[model samples]
Target: MAGLFISFEGIDGSGKSTQAKQLARALEQAGHEVVLTREPGGSQGAEEIRSLVLEGDPDRWSAETELLLFTAARRDHLERLIHPALAADKIVICDRFADSTRIYQGTRSGDLRNMVDQLHDLVIGREPDLTFLIDMDPDTGLSRAKGRGGTEERFEDFGADLQHKMRAGFLELAQQFSDRIRVIDGTRDIDTVAADVLRIAREAVGVAKSDA
Candidate 1:
């Protein structure tokens, strides 16, 4: 609450993870204390839950079940890592947050967005002060994601159709929460995108370019 809370969100392979890391590093080098973490896996307990939810078959868990698991992991992550860092006035840059679940489990299968909101409001009441939504073409993002070739293909395995739907869903959510979400064109080169991300982040955190 006292510090800046930032989250990077996007369809898979949209380069959000890379941008999150870069922001954290850049801020740290600028003499700020930074906590760079990710949802469903920031804390040790959450990391365990992450494997359960990310590595299995796409249909291994129903949307309802996956929602509960993700909520649990998020609670643990906040209690263990996010809260304390912010309390100490450190910048918290998370790769992904509840927004992902709102799209992934909320609307991927059915109209569960209401249920997702209720659960989020009940158990995970916090949101990032700033969010970077990396907008990318679904086909391009899916191809990039699958090329990584890891066990966490559960979501990527959902195929291009899901990616397209998710891309639309995220854009809609961005409009819904326009005050906090900054939509960035992720189709550009990495450096260009990162520069935009950093500029916006510095503005949000009140860091001047000269200070950096």
Candidate 2:
């Protein structure tokens, strides 16, 4: 809680990883101790759970099951990595956090959304000081994803329909958390996007420190 926690979120091919890395390097160059990590996998145990949830068949785990796995992974990540780093006053740049879980599972409808909220409030109450929501067209994201050809292709296999839904979900989240979520335009070239990310991140980090 003492550190500045930032999370980058977007659809599969929204370049969240690249931008996150760039931001971490930028912050580090600015003399800040930054820890760049990702969700479902940040710590040792979480990485193991990541493989289980990401590599297998998409339907291998039900929505509820996946939620449990993600939440479990998050708990370990926070206890083992995030919380300690933050307590030491390190800048933590997370690729994705609970927002990913909220949108991914929240799409299932009914009480699932409520469940996510309750679980997060009960177990993972913390939120990023700033959230970068890379906004991109689902078509563009899917195309980029296809070009990657990675084994972690389960999410892409869901087709454009799901990607559209996911995009909407993220955008909706940006509005909901607009005070903290900066919806960055992800359609531009890599450097341009990174520049925008760094600018906003610097502003947010500065403001967070000022508020503190």
Candidate 3:
């Protein structure tokens, strides 16, 4: 693809969304077309599925079932939004991507990381050119998440322990995909974090262009 594909990943409250938005603005000002989107709710169909997967009781869906719903949403999101945008040579800045599933479901359901990878390969098959993992203390992330106060409380309801596990999982994934993933300290000031994000993303954009 001629366009750059990027994903921001982290435990909830890692300020990934803020950084993704800021990067989009920065790229736009630099004369690039950017599509800033999120998983589980990027497209219309996926967004409807988002409410189904994120709301209600924590056990409203079992691990396997929840994974299925997320996969379906991701497929819709890619087909309707991400794939098209990338094909048109626009930078796609996604707030969260498959890494979230590999971490979230794997942490909750135990021994399912393999299944997550298999499903991703079979369905999505595409990986971002660059991924930014916002690293932060679990307590800080949990507190920030709680402050947001939204109906999508199911994941946030996992509490501190789960978040700690998620942090470990994300760090592990970043190591595994070190060539493509950048772990950025997210506990810093918002502008500081954005500056780092912009620095890394600009490099990814340049590399993608060179590759093209």
Candidate 4:
């Protein structure tokens, strides 16, 4: 409880994963103990789940099935990796979290708000101290994702309409939790975005350290 939990969120190709890594390195360089992790696949078991969730054929996954799979992986990730790292007083920087499910699955699936909420409660019992939402246009993000030269995943293969809805979901969540979530413009230069995230993270950690 005394440790810090920070999560990075954004649409695919928003550079959140890159930013998370940079931030973790920066924190480590500053002599802080940092645990860099990701959702749907932080642990070995969860990683296998990630491959299934991302690379698996969309025809094989219903909305409800996808949600359950995500929560299952999350449960394992939280119990085996994230919680323990935080308990040991390390700064845990996660690539994504429950918010992604609420946005991607809840919004896209329609009328699943209650289900998403219940799954969130059951899986992630504690909220992160700070969450950075890197906001960007879905088209731009999709283009960037394509440039990465890898096979597109099921989520990545979603059309612009779904991506727009997903982005809107994230924005709504950020607005609803303005105090805990910081929305950063992700269209900017990578270094600039990274600097903004680092500053916010440092401030949060400073406050946490003082309170401790």
> For residues 122-209, what per-residue lDDT tens digits would candidate 4 score against the true structure?
6667778999999999999888876787543677777667777888889999998898999999989989998999999999999999
Check candidate 2 and list the clashing pairs: none
lDDT per residue as tens, model 1, 147-190: 99989889998899999999999999999999999999999999
Report how far residue 111 has shifted in candidate 4, in Å.
1.6
Task: Go through the candidates in order and give the clash count of each.
Answer: 0, 0, 0, 0
Residue-wise C-alpha lDDT for candidate 2, range 16-54, written one tens digit per residue: 999999999999999999999999899999999998887
For candidate 3, the 10 contiguous residues with the lowest summed lDDT are 104-113
In model 4, which regions exceed 4 Å deviation?
A: none
Q: Count steric clashes of candidate 4.
A: 0
Clashing pairs in 3: none
lDDT: the better of candidates 3 and 4: 3
- Which has the higher TM-score value, candidate number 1 or candidate number 3? 3
- How should the candidates be ordered by lDDT, best one leading? 1, 3, 2, 4
lDDT of 1: 0.92
Total backbone collisions, model 1: 0
Top lDDT: which candidate number?
1
Each prediction's TM-score versus the true structure: 0.96, 0.96, 0.98, 0.96
lDDT of each: 0.92, 0.89, 0.91, 0.87
Give candidate 4's TM-score: 0.96
